[model samples]
Target chain A: MLLKAEKITKQFLRESRNTNQFCAVQETDFTLEAGSFAILTGRSGSGKSTFLHMLSGLMTPTSGRVLIQEKEIYSLSDKDLSAFRNQHIGVIPQGQSALYSLNVLENICLPYTLYHKNAHQEEALALMEQLEIAHLQAAYPSELSGGELRRMAIARAFLRKPELILADEPTSDLDDENTKIVFAFLQKAAREGAAVLAVTHETDVSQFADKVFCMKAGVLTEQNSL
Target chain B: MKLANSLPVRNLKGKPVRTAVLLLLTTLLTLTVFGGTLMIISLKTGLHSLESRLGADIMVVPYEATTKSNLETIVLQGATGYFYMDNEKYQKIASCEGIGQISAQFFLASASSGCCSLSVQIIGFDPDTDFTITPWIKKSYAQNLQKFDIVVGNDLNAFVGDTLTFYGVDCHVAAKLDKTGTSFDTAVFTNSETIKALIQSSVDKNMNEFKNINPDAVVSCVLINVAEGYTVEEVLNDINIHVKKVKAIQTKDMISGVSDSLSGIADIISLLIAVVWIAGIIILLLAFTMSVNERKKEFAVLRMLGASQRKLAAMVMQEALLVCLLGSLLGIGLGLLILLPFNQLIEELLNLPFLLPSAGQMLTDTIAAVLVSVLSGGIAVSASAFRISRMDTALILRGEN
Candidate 1:
């Protein structure tokens, strides 16, 4: 197993006294194997993205532990956890995630440079070329279209070639053709032996996913395995 | 090429207007700090130079001359006019009970002689009885003044070995005095013999007032140093009572008016600097806050890409430092351009003695100003850097609270 979530749960305090607690993600035991493409489908506010955030080490669970390659991620210090995430996990966030000051190519290369590591330019360019954003290499994010920006975000996640890829609504604003390209790229990442976990509302994502899960009202359940 | 270049530099380049405004504020802060501080220092230095140049407790002048001329113009402003008391008056003042050192000085104006472009005051000191100008002139020239040998002041156009004509007589310039930012800087110094010759030549030329003067038997003014335990007022009163037709003036009384005006100007400059500093820091705080706040999402994105909170804060600080460094250097440059070239004009406008610190002191001051300006930027934006760095990445990424 590349990732194992053993009885993980997240709770938020209710601002109003009418409610005792708000559960963003309920108790859920989930495991993802190496070389597997998984999709968790849910509508907005369904907590699928919240679950993915926990798996990516972006949030701490109220209880329970998350282990990647048998190493508990949350057990590390904040600095260590951030460094581990940088070297091991790649996340494609929803909405406008690009750094406005940087161009498309610089944005894609940020994951490596953020750690003060050498960014491999030939690999980044190859990825941009594959995503069809090669011509927009020097274009700032503001100049990019919704679909083009989505592809650029996807390209940035793949720049490091991490062992775990977590993408949230990566295809939300992408059109059908661009959506196919992004999913194909995710499937290719999985085929090359990386565990890929993506959250989306598109049911068609199941066609490219090896394992499909559904989250409704903070409750996660495995639907089936491809 | 690695596409990840310095992000802060690019950020500043991206937002030109915000950067320019911040730059301008930092520039103004540094300008006021450096220029105002320098001006205050120069004024104080000039005052000290004036006091040293005066180097006397009381001056005895003819009462008729005192009626026509203010003590400040004759002593501080280097105004030239000849007024004489007999050698008998000098002898009486020298024998006063509290007198420590006494010197008799002669004054002759070269303005009417038409040997120089501007009105130059010619001061003739009795080398034997003089303790005032001779000791200062010794710093430049070791040899005593021969017949017409002269030591010019720092501002004079003549150099050592140059011929300076006084009353159509060629006076040899033996040496030059260092700049003191006093009237001495514009005056020429020589022995009594040279000036007596010049005075006689003026009378021979049939000059209006010079024709009536007797340079041999008269002394222009008697400069007196009071004893250590005695007061200038005591000695001045003694001279006034004993000497007939002579008024005694204290050097301190001559410069008190200038001191009061200098204190007022110094206070105003200090207040201006305080206001500018407060305003500069506030402006910088606002600029950084807005710039950082607007990029919350962007910073969140960087965090998600595994940028540590420290790295995020460093980026913001780097941008601030760059702006501050550039702004301060430009401000210092602009200040030098204004203060250095127009120093004389500034002195004239303020009507105060003005002397700049040495080049080495100025260089140190410039470095200190730049460091302070840049450090201020860091201090002002520190809170913002901390706020953004410690922001909840998940909440920001989700675009929610």
Candidate 2:
């Protein structure tokens, strides 16, 4: 497995009520290979985002292990995890579109700037051209069409050439034609040797992935082929 | 100012109101601390100048100490205060090895002018022999030097050239000094011979008591100027051994008895200003903390970008230092503006007699303000950054409440 999780669970505690802890997700187990795109899908409140956060190492499970490239990422310190998030992995958080201050190119080059990695503008331009969104490269997010903005978000997520990429409801606002185009870019990213794990309640993005996992009550069940 | 180098700077322009408020508050705090400190510095400067002008190496007077000083009658006005020692003792006191020069001064009682009975004191000093009177004589020698010539101190110049009949003795103002802001500034200077002649005239005016008076016992106090090799202590010991019936006191002993009480009052005024300075710092700290809290996501984002907490703390401190430096500069400028002219007013209030912070003192105080502001900001930044860094990155990523 290129990425792995074992017996992972998460808990939420109440400070005001002094009540016992409640579980957000429990005993979550999943793995994905390097070149496959997987979708973790569930209805709202079914812990899909929580599971995705754990898989990306942004949130640590209460009592389990998450390994990427044979290193237990959750066991690493916060400093190391930040380093990991900057380079070895990528995340596209929902609601906030490509950082409010950045132009599309700047947003695409964020991982390089954040990690102090090589300023690979040539590679970013190549990716933009490869994904057919090079025309919108200089535009700020506010100036882009919804389809172009979705493409911009994806460019940022895959900026670092990470071993894995995680996206949360990335195309929820995109049109059907734009959704197909986004899935094509994501599939291309997987074929280019990065694992893409997408969390969505929408079935359209799920059908594009090679593998799909449905989550419920903190449990995830994998589908062999979507 | 080019965009290439101003991307980070442009971030401030992105939110002008917040940045302006932050800058304004920082300026106010800096100005307050520096302004108050500058005032204290100005007061001290005034006091130092007054001390410089006093020019007395040693003073001899009764032990009763108070703050008020009158340059004229006490020095010019003879027979005003308690002790009237025999002027003949000046000769014996001068015999001491360390006794290089001495001036005998007499304080004559208050005299009435044309309309209002103004408070007056006068002093008597031999401009030819007295060390204390010699320095003052230089100030008057330019205008007109006469046996009965008088150089009025700065404040007494208000009554300058006003022909005042002191016990029916007449003298004209030969020159007047710029106010020293000391009690001396309120006193008039006349020739020692003229003052003696006036006092003897006054004594003679009360002609019934002429039989009981002693002619040799004339002046008020002997101001001793000790030699360079010896201190006032040796001179005091010498004078006590050689002379009889006169007490000797060093300049500082005199100041401690007089100026110290007045300075004690000024010290309280400075303390109140210091409170305002401290309050300004505390307010600045609170503003910085609020700014830090508001920019949590910004710091978190920076942290994720490998910007260390140390760097973040340094940035805050640097900003604070800049604010402090700018504020302190503005304050020093404002202080100098207030002092360069109104210095006389401050001296009058503090009884320093003159005040102006020097360029060197301004530089030192600016450096000190910068150091203090940055240190305070660094501490505040570290405090808030501790809370910020401890936050789960997941909270930011998830956009959780």
Best by lDDT: 1
TM-score of chain B of each: 0.92, 0.67
Clashes of each: 0, 22
RMSD of each: 2.6, 7.5
DockQ for the candidates, in order: 0.60, 0.20
Model 2 TM-score on chain A: 0.91
- What tens digits encode model 2's per-residue C-alpha lDDT throughout B32-61? 556557666665565565566557777765
Candidate 2 residues lying further than 4 Å off, grouped into runs, are A97-108, A115-153, A173-181, B1-13, B55-101, B104-222, B225-274, B299-345, B348-351
Worst 10 residues of 1 chain B by lDDT: B110-119
lDDT of 1: 0.86
